[model samples]
Target: MSDTITLLYAQSVIWLVVFGLCAVIALMFRRVRAFYRRIAPLGALAPTAATIAHLPTTFLRSFSGSEVTAGGSREDGRPQLLVFVSGSCPVSRKMVPIVDDFARRERLSLLYCGDESDEAQKRTIATLGLSESGFVNDAAIGRLLGVDRVPFAVLLDPTGTVQARGLVNNLEHLESLLGVQETGYRSLQGFMTANPRALTG
Candidate 1:
């Protein structure tokens, strides 16, 4: 009788451990499935150049006053070009001159949104001649724009939909989205890099 009881106890302990391990594995599988589901939307999207030309309407709210640029003018119109920069990002510096020139020429409506309290940021904007451009203080615009990193630019229609987006560090991705034949645009790589950031929390 004593031997039987010990065997029963040992069996119970073994079963419990097995069950716990199964539960942990199941939980991990569920988390991975959820991550895949979020990004699946992008996979289903056929990122053709023609489809990319039309700007999609953005779902975020617009800024109303001095807090943002063009009196929130960029927000009210169709998807316009939006760029995000940080006071410390070197890549942003490389693109600022291009952005300022693009905006000044009115080739596209550009909005430069960045961290507000840094005095150097003010100087950076002034130096770039974007002081009167549609400057916004909102970080959400960047997130909403699906920007996961700095030195990024997006061509938005007046509706706020992202027509095209990429590292514009070379403007190749930008040109591709616009359907222009640029010598060095890598649309695939840009989309691949930005897709992960767009779907993740």
Candidate 2:
């Protein structure tokens, strides 16, 4: 009986040690993941609104002279994509093309919020060859939207209901926000192919 008790105690100690090692490994992996995400510009993961829960609001005192054209006469239609960004944010700069493509293909309304100078704004517009049809800027809009950071995007339906909102750092997150299920935004071709039929009245 004494020998049996000793064996059981040794087994328990071994399991405790194993569990401790696993916990430490998990912690190490989490830190490594965070490090990689920061440097890699995770254009693949979909971040939730909760991630920006601590983000600050815009501090601009005045609005730009540039006007943002509100699109669609329809009382009910596709969601509005509001992107808050600045010329300095690397993530926002990278997502410019993604937003442009979404606007063109989906024929959705898009609004960009920031306190950009007139010359810089004009250059950005020209560089992107953006359609004046749907683009707009209002720094105050960020305050109303509770935005304080760059590279932020929000999705709102025609009824002004927020559908999905988050940081536009990755294609996956954008895809999910746009209501792309399954493989989400990663499967852009499949989405475009199936979207028309899904929306047909």
Candidate 3:
């Protein structure tokens, strides 16, 4: 009878250990899922209704007669970086310095397009220390680029292909657009989805 009880107790202990191990495994999975969700780069604002990626963009000249080509042969042979901003948008104002620094550092062909009047566009250009030649007063370019939000950016490759485009609220967000292009992902979320192991590693 003692031997029987010992055997039963050992079996019970084994079962308990099995259940505990299962619970631990489940907890680990939950933690991993949470980690992925935390590290996944997602934007608060959605993209414009029109899809801009991989599409040819149209060009319009700035108010100062400087050629603003979005997707075409570049005279300078440098990639173009088009940014949409408004005079009334505080976010756009905040991004001016950041954009200016990026433009100078990257040597990108930068164009600041907006729906604001020519005066307002000029004022913004002056405030940002960007040349008037780089400021476009037309809203049509923004519409064609699917930029419904202020402080939006679209990076075009040298061959005039849309490399990346998105609403940018900060420098990190702006860099993520370039990251999307480098990774060949439509967005940061797409990158994370395809490479979940990246986060864990």
Counted clashes in each candidate structure: 12, 5, 0
Per-residue error at 110 for model 3, in Å? Answer: 0.8
Candidate 3: give its CA RMSD in angstroms: 8.8
Global Cα lDDT for candidate 3: 0.74
lDDT of 1 by residue, 32-110 (tens): 9987887623211223232333334433322224433321235445335677676577677777776666655546766
Please state the error at residue 147 of candidate 3 in Å. Answer: 0.9
> Where is model 1 more than 4 Å wrong at Cα?
1-79, 103-106, 115-120, 123-129, 180-201
| Regions of model 3 farther than 4 Å from truth | 1-38, 43-46, 51-59, 119-123, 126-130, 189-201
lDDT (Cα atoms) of all candidates against the true structure: 0.56, 0.58, 0.74
Indicate which candidate wins on TM-score: 3
- Candidate with more favorable, higher lDDT: 1 or 2: 2
lDDT-best of 1 and 3:
3
What global local distance difference test value does model 2 have? 0.58
Q: Per-residue alpha-carbon lDDT of model 2 for 1-201, expressed as tens digits?
A: 999999999999999999999999999999987767655222222232232222232222223444433322325465567777666676777888888777667676677666567667666556555444434556555555556676777765564555555567766657666663233432233444565443332
Q: State in Å the error of residue 165, model 3.
A: 0.8
- Give each prediction's root-mean-square deviation over alpha carbons: 14.6, 14.2, 8.8
Give the candidates in order of lDDT, highest first: 3, 2, 1
